[model samples]
Target chain A: MRIERADFPTSVTLDVRAGQPLALVGPNGAGKTTVLHAIAGHLPIMIGSIQLGDRELVELAPEARRIGVVFQDFLLFPHLTVADNVAYGLRMCGSGRKPARAATLPWLERFDLSDLAGRYPHELSGGQAQRVALARALAAEPEALLLDEPMAALDVEIRDEVRAQLADHLRDFAGPTVIVTHSAADVAALAADVVVLERGAVTQRGTWESLRAAPATPYVARLVERREE
Target chain B: MTPARRSGPAVIIWVIAALALALLVLPLLGILLSAPWPHLPALLVAPETLQALGLSLLTGVISTFCCLVLGIPLAVVLARSVGWAVVPRRLLRAAVTVPLVLPPVVGGLALLLLLGRNGILGKYLAQLGITLPFTTGAVVIAQTFVAMPFLVFAVEGALRGADRRVELAAASLGATPFQVFRTITVPLVAPGIAAGAVLCFARALGEFGATITFAGSYPGVTRTLPIASYLASQTDLNQSIALALVLLVVSVAVLLGLRDRWLPGVRG
Candidate 1:
């Protein structure tokens, strides 16, 4: 997919084969999230086009794009149960009660959240909430997935563990997924290709190995240094 | 509990707070003590009193429903302007709140000029064989007119405080705008909506000046509880006191029910 947002003064162009996860890593205010938002049709892109598999996404409404997003803080509906949160998108698309509830079963099992089906978002720990959020996103069966700061809100001790778990899931997903984060560790663990953004511009794009071997920008060089530390 | 040390300024602050509390409560205390206990039951059972009470309850409920239907959307519109430039939003807010600060009698007069039989749109209504002045429907309109601002402001405050990021997340999850509004927006601010509805209901129940001016006091029609109590004051002092006591008790109950919101740190 190629997405550009001139309104944000940021333009991003990328191509991804299905089942390959790309990471958009940058410093804060580098417009990593802005790029993801433009692709998801949340923020309007004034100049340039966003196309996914011959379908123009820039002009489509968010609901019409068939894209799933897991936010930085999970953004689970606090009033809904774990199962109901997962079931929400299906229900919105006109699924019956039985079908929606049934659809959440596999995702709940996949995320190891079956036992927490009846619990509210507030009752779940941060790690559990993250899993539930991912499950909620996956239940919608979108053409593409976008995750913003996937491991940012997790407890420091469990961050790597969750990252490993998420990496396992991303490997199995057969969609073009983009994860926006500032963490080099997240880029190393969860993604195959890294797109380094700096100051609302594309600084470098390559495999982590290539980017580290010949760091193109000061930001990429710093990221490699931070990753080593 | 041991007393903490208090300085002169702290002691003065405490005394002033207590005095302010008394200023609010003393009038209610007077109402409670001065109610005619001996004849309260009889006064309450009187046919006119029962009719007025039933009418008040009915109109109050219907008006509250109207406020919910109209006010919630307006509140959402107003709240959505939070990210925009301030001046136009403030102007819209002031326009909606005009009825709140405007005298109830004046509001009733304005409504009469717009909807009364001989008035502007009312002339058209008259041609269609309809007359709104001195009607039961006019009572509901007046109460809604005077009370809708309360609901709008309350829900707007709630909407303003809600997390917009969650809404963006929902939209990305393939929820249509209406679906997001129903499932996400409404539930997130459910407490505010409930509070606004309660405030709307109470205000509608107590509405007097606008209802009297627009609908006029016709027995079993526009003469609601407040109007009945007012009429009672001319003939029987005991009945009026009993009705006033009822109103006071209801107001106290509403205040207590909303204590958590107004009186912070008070756990039920």
Candidate 2:
């Protein structure tokens, strides 16, 4: 995946190789989610292009971008049951209900959500909801995945467990994955590489170990301290 | 902490509130007290009464359906118009609100000028051999014109209040814009739509001015229950009160039943 845009204070350019996950860490209002939204085609890139392999994603509509986005809130459709939510993408792709449900079974089993298939989003725990959001996004079989603050919505006690599960899931998918988060723990657990975004521009790019050894900015230093704590 | 004591202003406020409640309730109380209770069954079963009742219900239902079909889309557009220029958005809102505040008789006159024979669009409709005024269709049109704002405003509020991020989530999941709207947006606002529909139906049922002015009273054709009740007032006061009592009961029953079933957190 490649994103190049010049609308920011400094030109922002990013690349993630296939099967490699990158975490974008930034302070609040640093435009971390904006980067994910641009890649997912939810926002327009005024002066640049987003390319997934050879396909120019910037010109496509969000639905046509073949990019899965797990939003900060999970955004599980409150009206749909767990099974139906998982099956929604397939249904939208013109699969019959029976076939969609059939295709959703593996995802449900993988996420350990089979028992909760009939339950609504309101009934799910935060951890379970996170898994459901991941399963729902992956079920669509998109070419790329963007997760905005995936662990932000979970309880602090469950974040580590959910992050491990999320990392496992990310490994199983072949697409380039980008996670927008503030936590250094998320970077350590889920991403192969870390990109520090500040004020809509990438300030540093390296593996978590390298970033920890030599932090780029005060914000990065604080993130490293928090991780140690 | 000790319970806050009611001040002198609070006592005065409570007294004024009771007076306001009485102002609203006394008329309905008078209707109930003056109704010919013993003769209600006989009066209600009369052919004229039954016809008016049936017409009112049929037109009310039809108009509500019309409002849903038309108003839901309008509400969606209006709610999504937040990105539009301030002047245009305000103009659109003001246009929608006009019928809500304008006198029903004026609305009827507007409809007449627009759709009545020899009127603007009505002249062309007349050329097409489709007269709208003084017909059953006119009653429905008038009712829809007056009652649509209720549904539009309600559904618009719901649409605006709905979490739009969920829609982006759906789009990211490869659901087309239309699919997201149909599967996610509509279900999210279904309760609002239901509440709006009930309000629209009640408004349509109680419609008197527009129906009278645009469609005129023609017994089974346009003389709905409210119009019939008004006509009966000139002849038999007892029968008029009886008809009104029927309207009051039906409206209350519908509001209570649907409100409890669909509108959670709205119960008294």
Candidate 3:
């Protein structure tokens, strides 16, 4: 998959291979969310094209693109039960309720959320909501996955445990995964390759250790050194 | 209740709150106190009174339904027009809310000019063999014209307050825009919509000036409860007071009945 948008303060291109997790690390207002939103087709890309496999993502609607997104706050439908939330994507694709429920069972089991299937989102803890969000996104059978600040909303005490769980899920996912975050620890643990973005531009692109060793810019070097600390 | 030990700010705030509460509730209290209780039941059971009450309910419900059907889309467009040009957005908002600020009689006059027989659109409507003025339908139109802005404002506020990220997430999961609106937007703002509908109904039920101006007060036809009360005041003050008490009681009951359902935690 490739994405390019040439507008100032948001101009950047991303090349991602299938089954690889790429983390775009940047400071606040570094256009990280803008990049994720652009790839998710929420924001229009004016100057460049986004091609996923043989399909051009720029031509498709956000719904038709089949791109699963886990929002920063997890945005679980408060009105829906855990099971229904998981089943929503299937229902949207025209599956009947019975079949949608049937297909959603595996996702509940995979997230260890089988017991909470009937509970509303408000009833869940942060960690539980995060898992439910991931399950909801993956249940849609998307061509790619985009996670925005996956662990940012989690409690600090549970961050490591949930991050490990999310890493495992991303490892199991066969499609390309892109995560935008300010946390270098998130990149180290979850991402295979890191793209250092600053001021809406890619300053460095390589594995975490290579960027840590080479230190392309002061911001990238500071990020790497902070993670080591 | 002691005045001796109160702090300065607390006393000032309490005074302001008490004055505001008095401003709101004193008139209603006066009405309740002034009503002649002994003659109330006989007055309400009168044929003209019953007819007007029934007409009020019917027109109020119809107009509230119309407001819901028409106003929800208007509210959605208004809320989503945040991205639109500032001039047009403000103009639309102002236009929708014009009835809220415009005198009810003037609103009725405008509707008459637009839809009265021999009026611009009314001429065409009359040619089709449909005359609207002084009809029960005209009463409903007048009520809707004045009352819909309350609903549009309420639902628009709710829609703006709703977390739009949920809609985006639904779209990303492959739900169509209409699907997202139905399943997500509507449900998220259901409480606001319900409250708005109730408000619209209450406003429509109480509509007097517009109904009288546009539809006229004909017994068992365009005459609603307010009109009946006005007509009764000319002949029998006690009966008019009774009718006023009925309207007050019904409006209070409607609010009290649905208060907790739509506005949880609000103390009556």
Q: What clash pairs does model 3 have? A: none
User: lDDT values of the candidates?
Assistant: 0.87, 0.91, 0.91
Q: What's the true lDDT of residue B20 in model 2? A: 100
DockQ of 3: 0.58
The interface RMSD value for candidate 1 stands at 4.5
Query: Worst 10-residue stretch by lDDT in candidate 2 chain B?
Result: B259-268
Clash total of candidate 3: 0
What RMSD does each model have against the real structure? Answer: 3.1, 2.2, 2.9
- What 10-residue stretch in candidate 1 chain A is worst by lDDT? A1-10
- Tens digits of per-residue lDDT, candidate 3, B119-159, equal 89999999999999999999999999999998999899999
Cα error, candidate 1, residue B262 (Å): 14
Task: List, residue by residue over A78-190, the lDDT tens digit for candidate 3.
Answer: 88999999999999999999999999999999999999998889889999999999999999999999999999999999999999999999999998899999898899999
Lowest summed lDDT across 10 adjacent residues in model 2 chain A is found at A5-14
lDDT of 2 by residue, B1-268 (tens): 3345647678899999999999999999999888788998999899998999999999999999999999999999999888999999999999999999999999999999999997999999999999999999999999999999999998998888889889999998889999998999988888899989999999999999999999999999999999999999999998898889889999998788665466422121
Candidates' chain B TM-scores in the order shown? 0.90, 0.94, 0.92
Which ranges in model 1 have alpha carbons more than 4 Å from their true place?
A6-8, B1-6, B84-87, B259-268
Per-residue lDDT value at B203 in model 2: 94
The CAPRI-style docking tier of model 3 reads medium
Ranking by DockQ: 2, 1, 3
